[model samples]
Target: MWLWITGIICFIVAVRVIYNRRSGVCTSKKLLDGKTAIVTGSSAGIGKETASDLARRGARVILACRNVQKAQKVADDITGTTGNGQIFVKQLDTSDLASVRKFAKEIIDTEKELHILVNNAGIVAPSVKTLTSDGLELTMATNHFGHFLLTNMLLDLLKKSAPSGVVNVSSDGHFFGKNLVVDDLNYEKRPYPSTFACFGQTKLPNVLFTVELAERMEGTGVTTNSLHSGAVNTEIFFKTNKITDYMFGFLFKLMAKDEALGAQTTIHLAVSEDVENISGEYFADCKIAKRSEQAKDRGLAKKLWEMSEMAVSLTQEDHHYAGK
Candidate 1:
């Protein structure tokens, strides 16, 4: 009987933590009045919440989404709620080079300075080896390379904004993907672990991108950071869990926070005045956490940057990917 009581008490405590939430250590105050933000994948999940938060704080949010109808709906919702600001929906398919170029040209043509670039758009499908029309792995191409190209294309506007920032929404997935057999980057030669490795390899690229971009952006005042949004109950895995969707169960609930909790870290990195000067840091649960040794490897970071640039068709000839 005593053991049963103790178990119930522990269960209650765990539930509180899993659903735990706060306004963050940094003030929830609006300090982003004059900022302009571009948030990719703003139709749902953390991205949507982050856009809303930024909008409420007085930032003009450009919703870069792949689905035109969904983007319009999200824009309508945000516009209705945050009347003090505007939400511009821009169609962007990060996997398609043509789409990426079109979006970049849109920003370029508009001549509006982008102060915040949230690389929040990403896809995590099952173990199948898929490739973009550009012939790049689906995960790496969308998650890292797409953001890389977008940043490079918008580099001038960001620089003009002066005190700009870039937030890469990474995963707590690098530890499981060290020294990934590059020869089989597509996981075709040997069957890779379906769920884990598929996402893990792309996450590794995120860390390297952060490190290399930070080094190159030393004097740009354009702080860059990646984050592991602490396991959240977002739609990121809705496609993978048919049983969960069917049953509407909460088995992973104890380990999952809601989308709001996940968006907290992203908002912090994007607009908080506390870390205005802080850059090249990895965050977890809204706090700076130590990263894996692989994340700190400058050499690895540089190599990954070079390969990614090539994959995305972005090079120094345009915007000096490597700081001169």
Candidate 2:
């Protein structure tokens, strides 16, 4: 019995070693000396690591997060660790359209040029169905709609700063969202089964949005791409119930990648010269990765774009910024 237990432990250790080795690492030494970047939800987790990587590359990074105090703390830490004091903290709650608009306006007014926009802010859906002030489902609103509006609002700036990139942090879990109803994005007609259900549903839009935006901005020099950073042990799970928190904590330590590894694909997309001309593609492990058939459906992407615009109540003025 003891021999069997020892063998099992050895196998688990070997598998973990192999898994971590397979995770991608961004080896680029590219510098972002004059570039500026905004990473939403940067106070912690994958977002925080991504922000730190950008700062280390000499980019002026804005930590756009809902918690100003927490974000400031992160900014200070990045500055101290990277010796890049250009890190700034801005308040942004992606679940709230008002907060999104407010943050976008401040960025446009103060920043002369914008080079990277990482839509990394996200939250796990509550076990119970919930709606935001905008009357949109909480998870969809934060993970998708808010980002939709923010990206369109900042499109002009990104264009003016030619050779810019938008790196959206999507997930492999999008595969579970094959049954997403484009018309019922807010889950009005559909039942919200579980937190996992809502999470997968929202990730689909991240890829679809990238596909459509890439086509729209083809010649504008503003590239858009989405990526799935393999599952990492991040703080997102702590927001769930105690049971889930404990469960994921144990599982993540056993199987998930660390935060720095999780941020590699995002860092690569933001700084890699190889993909300078690449757009509208999904990526994993620092390479162009295949997405689900639905993610590649241009017609569906276009339809979702139109629906999202209306859902966010985007105005004619906002449309002016979106690449026509």
Candidate 3:
């Protein structure tokens, strides 16, 4: 009888967990009537949901994605549901340096006011080591370096809009890396044991970039913050091995937050008045959270910044903002 009672209690607990995984909490419906926002990887998952939420608040949202067709469809859906037709789709493949340059150039040439920038696009580490066209590791190129370049290229516009915000979608997996090998960012010297470790390595730079960028933009009024959106049930884990993917799917179904919930912290940082003056902070569950020691290393942050400039070939002339 005791065993039977215990079994029933466990079953009830399991059901509650699954329910929460399916239904996420609603974010505050603060209006952003005239703001122009860019959300990379906005075609699906947290990116898509975040974009939708922003549109609902009357923001003109640009769904920057690699696949124009899918992005167009997402834009149409958001328009249909929200009755906000200000959504536009643009091509942006963050893994490629050329593509990043093209996208930034187009935005800079076209847009008048740039208010919110969400670097929400990312990929899980490849099962095997792969190199991008720019001769950098694929995961590092897509997750960190590409966004690094894009953000820097648009820094002037963000500053001009003053009080603008940049939201970086980092992950809790950053703690998995033992230490960042600044010299071997491409993982040529030290072989990664698994793609998970490689993924973690890239996330560290996201936080470090936020730290250093916030410092530079201190008086510029452009706040930059990073967040761990929680273990979300998204399509990122689908590209791995069948067995591994299935296991992750099962676990996520039982424990992961829905995409909407995962996007709260990102939306919080982007449009929340509470964090209007806040910068260089990491967030989780819509609150400021502590990051790993390596993430907070000021010296390492500066080193990474220099290395990123070298990787992207950013010159002094590229920096239009004198102080930044």
lDDT of 2 by residue, 181-288 (tens): 888998789787676777888998999999999988988999999999987888888777858766877777777888999899999999999889999999999998
The pairs that clash in candidate 2 are none
Give the lDDT of residue 197 in candidate 1: 66
lDDT for each candidate structure:
0.78, 0.90, 0.88
TM-score winner: 2
Candidate 2 lowest-lDDT run of ten: 315-324
What's the lDDT of the predicted structure labeled candidate 3? 0.88
Model 1 ranges off by over 4 Å: 1-13, 16-28, 181-184, 187-192, 241-250, 253-255, 315-317, 320-324
Off by over 4 Å in 2: 1-8, 321-324
lDDT of 3 by residue, 1-324 (tens): 999999987885786487565443445667999999999999999999999999999999999999999999999999999999999999999999999999999999999989999999999887788899999999999999999999999998898998799999999888875489877898789885486788889999999999999998888889999998887888778766757766886677556787888788888888888888999999888888878999989999999988888988886755754443
Higher-scoring candidate on lDDT, 2 or 3? 2
In the predicted model 1, the residue pairs found to clash are none
Point out the higher-scoring one by lDDT: 1 or 2: 2
> Backbone clash tally for model 1?
0
